[model samples]
Target chain A: MRSRSAWTIFWRTVLGRAYPRIIGAQREKSWVFFEIFLPLLQVTAYVYIYRAIEAPPEFIGFVVLGGAMSAYWLNVLWSMASQLYWEKETGNLELYIVAPTSRMAILLGMALGGMFATTLRAIAVITIGMLLFHVSMTVRNVPVLLGVFLTTLVALYGLGMLLSSLFLLFGREAWHLSNLLQEPVSLVSGFYFPVRALGQVVAAAASILPITLGLDAMRQLLFPAMLGDLRFLPAEVELGILAGLAVLFLILARRALAYFETLARREGRLSIRGQ
Target chain B: MRANGSRSEALRSLRVAAWLGWQIESNWADPFVFAIYSLVKPLAGALILVFMYAVIAKGGLQSPLFPGVFVGNALFIYVPAVLAGISWTIIDDREHYGMLKYVYTAPVNVLTYLVGRGVAKTMVATIAVVMMLLLGTLALGVPIRFGGIDWPLVLGSAMLAFFGILLGGVTLVTARHNYGVGEAVAGGLYLLCGVVFPLDTLPSWLSSIGRAIPITYWVEAMRRALLGERTALFSGLSNGALVAILAGSTVVLAVLAVLVFRLAERRARAKGLLDMQMMY
Candidate 1:
């Protein structure tokens, strides 16, 4: 009975949060339009820029894929990771802590909700890119591509959950910290370009992000001509690493949440607005 | 009698607003982090584009256009940082701090107060621009050949560009207050501003939109001033004529911003939206 109830509660949490977000976003028609379409313009600029310099046709597909994946990273940074900051500011964190449900459930809801939102936007971006730029993406193996994509999402969201716990310890500075993550991550992760183009040290640093490995794997798998057989590791090995990181982070996040909650309670820090 | 009293009051309010704006902007991050943060985004962008160009171009970094790309990316930082900073001031104060109603009720004119904030924000932006330029020239070895450059014209063009951005920011904030779409407007400007590549090479409609913006002229003028003989845009015009065109566009944008702000104010008052709670 207890096991059954836990499963029920988990699905309830995920669906409850995800449904409202989709509805709330849809209520603001303009928000939906801008969020979906604005990214395309940015992608278009980079594509045009690459063309102006006369990069190969495959590089355009590389850019499109990177741009699509970047939506999830932005969602992780701005929405999932920063959700704790929003909850604290609005006095929802106390209610969440007081509830009987696990805090992991809340983060799970965020990860799932963010994934849903970003997937819709990313699909639109990919479709428009394929249509507009005539980007040719031939998947060598469907199962491998799907596995890498799902594993990337899991690893990325795990990182988001970890960040949520860390950001809970912050006050208004969370805003600045979130802003600080954007462009540097774009550079380090090689969002619009290949990581190999960056040097060895930077490539080593990029491996700390699972998205980087996932991107390399996807590129090599999809467009072997453009990227060549230059991955730092094999595809299955990268996928294994990503899966391991996701599980490790989810476990660490739960423990960190408990510790931070106790610290906030004992130190009387949770409700303090802006330090 | 009353007119003189109001004018003096407005002047005093402007001074205080400018001071407060600077403090609010700087106090969030410590000095070191703020300096690093300013350098990181613009420099990273420059690095990415330069690396890509080096990979694709025939002569790689030896290409004649390499320095232009470096300088252009550095200047592009102004659009994101300054433009966002200016819009956020009003949005933050009114929405986040819940002080818009109180500020409006004060004896100070809203336009004057906004202009005061713009001055402080512009000062910070100017520092970022200079820092990016220095880092590009010194650390990155982006050859910024300074000989035969018309210094006065460049400075005048930069000043005009800054003013245009400030006024454009005012128009954006007012529109956000009315339309409730901040990110869309900011994103559109970043993409449409000819930041990364030349506007001429963009699609015809996009290029037309770019020509309508003041930043396009400023960018062209700056490039012409920096790379004197290589400019295709101003081959027919003298440096004096270029400066005149820039100044003309700046004044037009400033005037339009003031008009839009007044309209926004009237709309907000009519709808009783000035005191609405900020949505997350």
Candidate 2:
């Protein structure tokens, strides 16, 4: 057989890894009901809560947008970060380790697949939430909104890629850690409201998460009139921060993946299930 | 004599299952990490509601409605804890641990075992509820009077186990191919049960759906016990009436749970699903 170039192998590995998620997304019917419909129920609860308090109409917009972006964060946490831990439990980690392809390519494939799947759900959430709650948005800059959204996904999934290695190293703690991160990250990232309401210092600390700034910037652009004073930073600065976060997380993820590969090779424990 | 012997055997199974469940849940982390894990998740959950209220309530924490919302949200830790706890045990044992077949062939009553398994989560959630309530009263001024709390109503609300077992029974049948059943049911209940907002705030149709759910009354009863106030949704009902309704609904739910679990167990055995593994 002819030897494939490294570039060809890398692309194939990416495509190969992503295939299951993209295809499973279509094959699985339950995820749609659970991911899309049930999440809408959660978003609806928040919308009703805002209505109960008689918060401004724009606050409803905030909840809907937060609900939309949260889909990606959840995808990052469960599908991307904790995925290798799950793979280990299912006895697939050893195969990936032995495969003659870059581990990063495998993760990248998972990220691409997860992003595709989550984007569908996120769009569904936003559309349904808007129609149901009548949430109005100004959308001052479409290019900027798309940029922030895409950058947030990149940085968020990059963080996921890094956490995947650490989580695999930690074994069962990965499950509890993922669960612990869920609500806390949502709270810190200001998923259901403007991050500014969390105060400057806390919001500044939370900026380590790409979703925090991304959501803030998107809200600023989407609800500029109402959130003029509520934004944590100017959209331009948040965009720059998100850009920086995207690059930083990707680099850190690569280093961590390398370290994880080295440690797994030395210790020979990464493939062990139920550690 | 026979009935007493059977009852004791079931109790033994339940007790052992509870111990095993606790070991599985806690042994993954050391005492310190486990403590932090227990503390942070629930606090963060409560803080989400707190911050949500803060972002909107012009009166801040001083809003008259804050206590009920805070108490309701705090107590709601039980729904996911118990519901998902029981259901996830089925998935954990069958898929992750690959021990469900052995468990089935054992002398333990699977139903009792499942209920026992949920006790660990209930205990953890109880701690979280107490912590959140303390945080609410001390730090947030939620106005919960320990002396004024109705202990009976609070205890009665523990009948939520019936609902969890009911969901677990459904999970037993569906979890072969569906892993999200527990969370989906819990999330749907979060919306329908008026955890953070009154059912009245939901559309009339959805509010009617909420009213039909026993958890709506359970949450309301819990809030009443904790806060000494009735949400508008159940304001017309007296305290005794609320208890009667909760007790009645709980009995019906318990019966349904047992029946469904028996049916599911029989079906799983007949269909060769008891040992089926999907690698999900």
Candidate 3:
């Protein structure tokens, strides 16, 4: 009966962790500074691009929205994941692991901290984008944009928590995996210009990543009139794809966590050395 | 013996340094793993840039200034990736099982000890830089030709080395435990310095801020060095004066590094961080 209660508690702990991963709510204001820097350079990049090209007003809005959304998701998954893995490798995980709280709570604390940091960066870059590029974001697009952002955030962080578990299971293999996440997704997500900008294969791969799907859908909503070419892909298509990948990632994440816990109990620690 | 003793002691420190810095010991990963870590980011980063460029280029952003992503990346885009590569070295000393505390307690001069460690870390990082450059030139086709450099390139190389030392010193002192902040600063500096666009490409106020960083100086120097585009602003300065000033700045930087070393030593000693090193 006591063991049943403990298992029930772990499930509850995970649901608690989901609040931030899903709702995008962490302690506000205190983390506003970190967001300032991430967007600072990105907006500068966009303004530089805008001046070089006389794209339609709509296109500039597309750049601002796409860049902001993608940067947030990319930082959450890429930078945050590796930072977590490094903390684990340096034996920082021992502290969190030994904490009287649940594993879900620890993952929530670190990942939420990272997500918040990245979000801070994303918001700063968006402000810069708006000021520099003269982006005109409309109220109509905000609801859909928020929807895509929140859902993708859940998917990406879920992937992150899962990836974090892998380090616990496999150790050093986690580092190698971290490198593979961001750059490839950056290409795929079409952060700089358009999906048509990448090769067909690269574009296809980017379309598969949740961040890319979310950004593409958000782009379509922002530019609702141009449904013809689907250069950025359609909204429902992107939402469906993003939602699908997020679920697939979560299920696989749970499986990976189970294997990792078992492997760690048997092996003592994850290997930091690459073989 | 006394007459020769002074001269021998000078030579002996050299010998001691040579012995200490040259070895690959239990802490060999301090250099080796970090070197491997440093090289991977740029190779991956360059490809990511190529992807971003491909996207923007296709999106009809192409113009004369379009090289901002492709050509400008050689100066700007690669810095962040390279920073991520050197990620592990920030706390390499502290992470070693009590080795930092042991290092702090040693009778050897703190300057000598850190210099030895720096020499080791720098050697590995330098090798990693070379490998990334080669990968950029040969494998990735990044137009960062060492041979194509002219007068401007000469000044640019000095500036890059200057920035490298500054960053290395910062790592030794600040954010040693949290390298991500330093890495972000390095990457952000590259973007702000207008390596992709002219400093005029950013907001007027921000571009002025970017000007103070050595990045714009080096980026212009690199372009003039490699591409041989002699802008009037750059060509107006006497090459000899620029060289002299840059050289002087570098010497001052080395002095600053020594000060950072002293600070690191004091911190390690005060905090009992040197209790972990074991020697035969």
- TM agreement with the true structure for every prediction: 0.91, 0.97, 0.73
**Docking class for candidate 1:** medium
For each candidate, give the interface RMSD after superposing the true interface residues on Cα: 2.8, 1.3, 6.6
Model 2 has a clash total of 0
Model 1, B1-280: lDDT tens digits are 9999989887887798889888776777799877776567656766777767766766776666566666766665555544555556666776667787888898887666766776676667667777777776777676665676666556544443344344444443353433324345545655665656655667789878877776666666676666554345446777787678777776775676666667767777887767765456
- Output the lDDT of residue A63, model 1: 82
Could you give candidate 3's per-residue lDDT for residues A1-275 as a string of tens digits?
98887877766665555555445433433234434554455545654655544445665666676667766655555545554455555555566566555665556555665566567567767777778667775555677677777777777777776777766654444554565455445555766556655656777776656776776666666665334554566666667677787788777766776687667767866434321
- CA lDDT, every prediction? 0.72, 0.85, 0.55
DockQ each = 0.53, 0.76, 0.24
Q: By lDDT, who's the top model here?
A: 2
Q: Residue by residue across A194-221, what tens digits does model 1's lDDT show?
A: 7777877887778778788888788878
Candidate 1 global Cα RMSD: 2.9
Runs of candidate 1 exceeding 4 Å displacement:
A1-7, A227-232, B1-10, B145-187, B227-230
TM-score of 2: 0.97
Sort order, lDDT high to low = 2, 1, 3
Q: TM-score: which is higher, 2 or 3?
A: 2
DockQ of model 1, rounded to 2 decimals:
0.53
